[model samples]
Target: MNYYDGSFGGMHLIWWILWFFFIAWIFFIPADIPYQKSKKESPLDILKKRFAQGEISKEEFNEAKTIINSAT
Candidate 1:
């Protein structure tokens, strides 16, 4: 049976400090990081924006609308 004596107080203090840091890291760290902004956007909103910017022709927009409707 062996045990550390009180004479090594500095070593004990360092051990305590390390243990405190380890526990703090385990218990206080967040599991999921928060997003700055939402990434979710409805498909309709994207289609409307594209249509308004004249990026797609009316036929293409209707095709996209049909695809979106079918997907949902």
Candidate 2:
């Protein structure tokens, strides 16, 4: 019968692999659905859209734009 030494080299490798997977899971997995912003719309673009949709008048849009510019 052969006596085995209690070396932990294999266990160390497994622990390292598990740690890597844990970190990868944290980065890649989202806890909720992700939100995406429209690529085409700036603040001005959205204001124009609201005007076009008759949600606001051109005068109101200009007034809002002035307020937004002042706030920035």
Candidate 3:
């Protein structure tokens, strides 16, 4: 039982490196995957998008904007 053996310390260091790599991969790499849930758009943001796309008219956008602003 030679505690001074470098192989034991080397293996322990390798295990730590492996664990750190695994956790970093799990947390930092999956955000851009297409199946991940995206943040929900705010109501005002949706309204603005619709107005820009011509799905809603200026009057409708203004009314919705007013309502959303007042509610918040």
TM-score each candidate: 0.47, 0.40, 0.48
lDDT of 3 by residue, 32-56 (tens): 7668788999998899999999999
What would the per-residue lDDT of candidate 1 be over residues 8-54, giving only the tens digit for each residue?
Answer: 68878899999999999999886767565657779988998999999
RMSD of 3: 7.2
TM-score rank order? 3, 1, 2
Candidate models: Cα lDDT each: 0.89, 0.84, 0.89
What is the clash tally of candidate 1? 0
Clashes of each: 0, 0, 0
Instruction: Report the lDDT tens digits of candidate 2 across residue range 1-72.
Output: 755576767878899999999999999987766685446767877887898999998889999899878887
Instruction: Kindly state the number of residue pairs that clash in model 3.
Output: 0
> Which residue runs of candidate 3 sit more than 4 Å off their true CA positions?
1-37
lDDT of 1 at 67: 98
Judge candidate 2 at residue 35 and give its lDDT.
89
Cα lDDT of model 2 overall? 0.84
